[model samples]
Target chain A: MPREDQGPLLEFKAVNTYYGDLHVLKDVNYTIGRGEIVSLLGGNACGKSTTMKTIMGVVRPTRGSVTFDGQPIEKLATSERVKRGIAPVLEARRLFPRMTVYENLEMGAYTQKRGAQFDEDLERVYSLFPRVKERRNQVSGTLSGGEQQMVAIGRALMARPRLICMDEPSMGLSPLYVEQVFDIIQEINRQGTTIFMVEQNAAMALSIAHRAYVLQTGKVVLSGTAAELRENPAIKEAYLGELQVPAAA
Target chain B: MTAVDVYLQQAINGVSLGAMYALLALGFTLVYGILELINFAHFNVFMVGSFVGLGMLELLGVMPNDPALTGLTLVGVLLLTFAVTMVFSGALGVLIERVALRPLRNIRGPASMITTIGVSYVLFNIVLLGFGADAKNFPSPLPQVQFAIGGAVLRLREILIWVISIGLMGGLTYFVQFTKMGKAMRATAQDPDAARMMGVEVDRVIITAFFLGSALAGAGGLMFGLYYNITSYVIGFQAGLRAFTAAVLGGIGNVPGAMLGGIIIGLVEAFGSYWISAAWADVIIFSILVLVLVFKPAGLLGRIAPNKS
Candidate 1:
């Protein structure tokens, strides 16, 4: 494939990831352009989380390269990758339970030097999630599931990331929270941050994502505009839980 | 002297002894909090640190026969010896982690823990071979002043131990609670992978914990020598077990808990020695350890977590 005038912000070229002898991701290739929301859709054990981990440098690619901002960062540590502007809102909202809400946000900016800019970013996050500001002093472990999700997103935003990789943003959230969370995702993207999301909620993910990829058993089985995939019969049948029988059969 | 006054004096002695144990327990807790390794070699580190403090004092011209150095000069000499001993012990801790523990980090099971036992033996033999098996008298430079508060006598050496240990503990608390690196250490302790995601260097955090823990233990060693006026290669085993018991009593990973546990153990030992026989102190302490393990396995401050082990 020929390169565009402005290359993709993040790219995975034939990436293969493994956990010991168990092969998780095989020859996976995808790209997220700057300011675009890319959703990776998959079922259980389809390597969606592995893809996110590989991008964040938590899981290294055993074969192939992962490029971020046009730089090959295959061997970089997770902290180094964060320095290169990648921040992850990990699966299951792994907050430091003992720390207060404000402290959790402070930790998100650990890669950056402390100064005036931190307060500015903090205010930005606070403005985005007023609830997080209200309960800033409370221990994070004591927060409700929906409240914890808000803080988790607020924590990731404190990094001032150019590209945010959110793993299952809607997991364990109420319907009201899921809608609010997706709305916030769009708002975040509109303000100029590229998003690479791994989601099991195909319907909600496709609704906001500009481009999408369907992964199956460690391979990119389908890729197209979100609009096109939303209309595809195969996607609706498999992921959307809709039965599509051959009308002519 | 009434019975009340004697018990009061014993209580004061117990607090001073407890402060020293708290220092050692803090080291065990810091390293164990981050790595989940018992660091059995920390006992030897404390032993080595006492020897190093002795060496530093000798180099500074403080002799066994020399008159007690008073005023600012005594303060300066003590500070200098503490600084050198702490740095030496802290570096030794880092070296042990890098050499013995780091290699076994990725390997599952008790490889690193067993390695620590091996290291404890190596340091024990090194000290034995270098300094001989007999206990050496540790000379103190503080003036022999006795003061009484509410009919309880307190020595200058005991006062110094309390002051230095409390000061160091206060400093450790501030570092962990307020500073950026301290926050990283806490974050790493809570969830290392999440901390890594937030750009905290887990390796550096681990190193920092080891350094801080070992340095505190080093300070404790100096205090132990000053208070007991004795140093021996075999001292590490007994002291290490007591401190380890303190850590478990307070809650293994909890910082404030370790301090409390150390003090309690010290008090128990003191009271046991005074009330019962001196030989019964060890029996009582180990009995407390067994009772705590059986009843409150999570310790006085530790939360019950099914996943911790």
Candidate 2:
């Protein structure tokens, strides 16, 4: 994994956000480098999703700046941010319910305009989630939770984004699907696309993430390398509850 | 009138009336589908179209007695009314969007609904003050040609109603299915946030929806005036209510559904008036509404889904 000193891909400088004066995200400062899988770990209502949403321009920060590709994107609209290759798969896999799987994929490539490359993107999405191809004519609303997650991720990938933000991807998934989703995130990172993920499962998230940040009540309480966080006593007590030490052979 | 011939005549009249209702309902449904807001002021837009038709007829100097050039002049009046009403109603739709709907979109739903109702009342009173209480008779452009088909006599106005309504509906369907902008409108209707994220100018698409819907209502108004040969400020309320019911019956937001609902309601009214009793027309229509709601709450062609918790 690349060091944080190597210049980050996305930088949030003292960003603050609010939900109608509730002051949700407070002075959030974080960086995710290119080709890295960084996870934002926190319990519910800890501003983990808020951080991701702020970065995606869904929740505009009230103070400070967010820079993507070394340009300030704080004032840009969510769609403009998306066009700049920053895609987000929101929590709960909000797919267009009435649209067919193929149509849902086509909507993902909406920014690509009508061109030859649009077909190429569809092919790539189909290749990533072959089940989507099998059920191309099926409406997205009928898909299982795991399949919907796959469609959501695949849809984001179709945008040809340099960075993808995933919010609570493993919320209601079975353990096996959770592992599969994590593997896919790692594979996507291996393919050179950066990932900023918000996850409730701290152990699984830190296992794959190169770096991680722990948020509590709209503020970052902890930040370090994955190994350092895994070894931290406080993190173990707060997240893992009881540490499992391997027996001596 | 013979039993079979009267039945045929009523059916023809019902179908023609239903065609007009279908046109109006379609306009209402399109706007409702996209915006999820009831454009109550649309009724006045329709009435304004009739008034504009009256103005055009007067401009052409085709008095009620001048039967010499009346036929050609009536055609000019129809075209003129259609053009003027479309522009005027289109502008009114956009204005309402900008002034009332847009401002209140971010507000709560109830507030917006009440605001729209208020706007509707304001429009009604304004027209009443301008046009007064007397009903103005609209001069028909086409001669009242009636022909025998089987046992029933068909009126030219009735034929014109079908031709115009069906033609507009076909054109609209083609535009929505084939045009890029129409696709964008549908996309926006489905999911505004996602549509915006996909770089669709959501506001512009919304404005376009309003324009198209209002234009259709304007055309329907002109046709209604031509067929009924009467116009009044208060006429909009009855038409608007019936059209709203038609839209609801046709699945609220579905375009073709609105047309179907309109035609069904029209037939019900006509048949009820002819065979049952004219006084029971509304009761029959409302009964159908209750039946539709009880069985298919989503209306015809509406896809049912699990209710979101």
Candidate 3:
């Protein structure tokens, strides 16, 4: 549990998102405090990605409120949300493939005008991801999986966002690269950027997350501290592919 | 002129003609890139721009008395005409977008095209009613200035057309490649949703694209009046068709492709008229378009870039 001193950076209170009549997200609620890694874990079609989209204002909630930095932004447009410092690294690394790596980063800082802070943020991103610096001139599409992820992260960091939402950062990476991604996520969190990540890799997600939520069928089935969830029988059985407790089963 | 000299002179003529087409073609491509609309009204807007230039020239009045003074006055008037026509036409483009296209934003693709085609008719008729159907003799201020390079003899009008068109194209390229707003335009074209996520005001970018493109077409209209020394309301139909074809040939959404496509079409028309007959020139050009469509849908320089999500 985080200390009472630090306030929640993002809050989703009774957010119900729908795609026409599909009812994609059903009264979901979660909170991420400042300087914490909060992960949403679920299976295929379980609304993990929808949750991220709702945060970015790509999907408006039907009957709930989403407060970001204490402002109700449920009715705002995606571009307006972005200007408010809610940046997203969309599913499968949505870097502008036709653009150069450097150009992609510059685009991430679109809300900020050209000035000293823009340059400073760019330098900070380069220092955080040296591979991105070396491949700055290369087109984003040609980059390998791990390197592309670096560009995605570097691009998000360039915005100087209060919180960065990532979707499936480990979805298509090699085992070695997966470990590197998790380490980088922790490093990003350590540097005072709040993270709200959606993933299917529960073990990896829980390992670094300060607080974690396990969703099933568009609803939160389990939510607790990372340490508590790490030892929970339900998570181990459902996510880690372990034996269920006989009585509970 | 010898046989080679005739061909060389035709080539120079082709280049000047193609420069005007390039500007019109570039505008068409820019609109297509953002809105995915054919923008048939742009052709009529080109016609309006020519008329606007004529009106400015008339308003400025003809140079009187001293020959040297006439030269200076003509230069001043032409410059003023260029500035006024481009601004007037650019504003017209914005108006067309607001009145004819903006409300139809959610309409299916072909519906928008049909609407623009209707707008073209309305604008063409309006101009015809005002200016009358007869072709007006657009006066040339310069007194038959001529120069020769090897076998090819060139006129001052042709040289001026080339210089102005090339300068405009260069400026446009710089604006798109180096400026922030231009990047936003490309981003919006690629994926408007993703661009919105990146905090790009896609509507503004679309409007800017229209303004820039219409301005180029307006300048082309001015050049067309100067080079051909004639303006008719119906001229837009043929010119627009040719320029639209040029845009398709260069890859509808590609900037450089539109330019190259225009030049190629111009050259083909010129050479075809010389070698075959003036009546056969359009046939040859259409045949080339058919060939390009059949072989390479991406056009010469167009690389099919995947739309970002």
Candidate 4:
């Protein structure tokens, strides 16, 4: 891949991630340029989630490099990576169960010192998520799945992240909530924050994504502009469910 | 004194004793809350605190028969001793976490508990070597002043002990409830990986937990020495067991539970000593612990979670 005069905000150069003998992600390579909504699409167990985890340093890569702003961060701790402007809205929206929604947001700003800048980011998140403000005092565990998702995104935004990596934003939500979530994601991107997302629902993901990658097994099987990938015959048959395929492996 | 008066005195004594147990148990439970390990070395830290107090008192020459020492000067010395002991014990706790417990975190085993037991032995032996194995009388520096309250006679030391315990617990409660670091500790305890993803340094939280808990244990030990006038290296084993029992009684991981548990245990021992026999106090407390375990395993304040697959 030829580098633009300016490097990508995030890049995985031939990264191989494994859990013991189980090769979860193999020779994975992709880059998210600045201010891009880059979505990774795949079926369950196809390593879409693993790609997100590797970037977050929850799961380390066995080979190659993961660089953020051309700085290799594969060796960094998860919190260190997070401090370096990458916040994860993890799968299942893993909010602190007993903490209030406000406390959860506070935890998101743990890397940043408590000051004027912290207050500004917090106010911005509350404005972006008026519903979260409404449920500020409520415990996170008791929230509805959609509300929790809102909190998850709002919490990530509290980190003042340069690039927010989301693992399955549409995990257990109605079509209405999914649509609302994509709208918020687009809004966040428009505000100059880059997004890297993994989604099981390919059609909804591609609709908002500027660029997208299709993951199969441990490999990125397809990568292109969202419009180009959406028009690809294979993507229509496999992801968008627009065409029927012959019975095959 | 009448029988009712004696019982009232016993109850007061029990409450005071319970305060010390509550302090120790709070520290014990704090460690268990974050690391899920019994800090077996906590009592030793307490013992070291007692010695530290004894040494400070010796340096200040504030003994019971010291007529020349001013009350204000004695108070200053006492406060300085506490500061030194708590800080030292807190550092020791952080050291244990860094050198022993933190390294064992990645290993999939119950080795942390065993390592704590090892730490307990190491601390015990270190104290034994530094101070002789024989019991050293902790000279109560403050003048023996007793006052009657509600037909029960109480010493100045007794009242001061209760005040100090309440103050420490209150301060701890405020810190945990209102501070950012405290919130981070709670988040890390609930889910470390999630907390890290949210940019919390999990290691710092664990260190804080250990330091706070051990510092409390140290203060408890110094107070115990003052109250009982007995400071021996082996005292830690008995005190640690009782404190551990209190933590279990209240719910091992719950902070308020530990405090409640400690007080209850102290009250039980006090009443049992007065009503039954001093020898049977241990047996009575253990029986109560057995009953509580059989009935409420999550502990008195512990929340019961539904079964997880």
The Cα local distance difference test for each model comes to 0.90, 0.80, 0.85, 0.86
Model 4: per-residue lDDT, tens digit, A116-232?
A: 998898889888889999999999989999999999999999888999999999989987898899999999999999999999888888889999999999999999999898789
In model 1, the Cα lDDT at residue B7 comes to: 90
The TM-score between candidate 4 and the true structure equals 0.94
TM-score per prediction, in order, is 0.97, 0.89, 0.93, 0.94
State residue B13's C-alpha deviation in candidate 2, in Å. 2.1
The lDDT leader among the candidates is 1
Model 2 misplaced regions, further than 4 Å: A1-7, A240-249, B56-84, B143-145, B175-180, B294-309
Best first by TM-score, ranked: 1, 4, 3, 2
lDDT of 3 at B13: 82
Q: What TM-score does candidate 2 reach? A: 0.89
Q: Worst 10-residue stretch by lDDT in candidate 3 chain B?
A: B62-71
Regions of candidate 3 where Cα sits further than 4 Å from its true position = A1-6, A242-249, B63-72
Clashing pairs in 3: none
Query: Can you give the lDDT of residue A240 in candidate 1?
Result: 74
Q: By lDDT, rank the candidates, best first.
A: 1, 4, 3, 2
Q: Name the candidate that leads on DockQ.
A: 1
Residue-wise lDDT of candidate 3 within A39-128, one digit each (tens)?
A: 998899999988988888778899889887777889987778888788888778877767789888888998887899999998888888
> What C-alpha lDDT, on a 0 to 100 scale, does residue B48 get in candidate 1?
94
lDDT digits (tens) for residues B45-131 of candidate 3: 889888888778767764222132246776787788899999998988888898888899987758888988999999899998987
Supply candidate 1's per-residue lDDT for B163.
88
Question: Quick one: RMSD of model 2?
Answer: 3.9
Task: Summarize candidate 2's per-residue lDDT along B109-158 as a digit string, tens digits.
Answer: 57776777788888778878988989987776677678988789888888
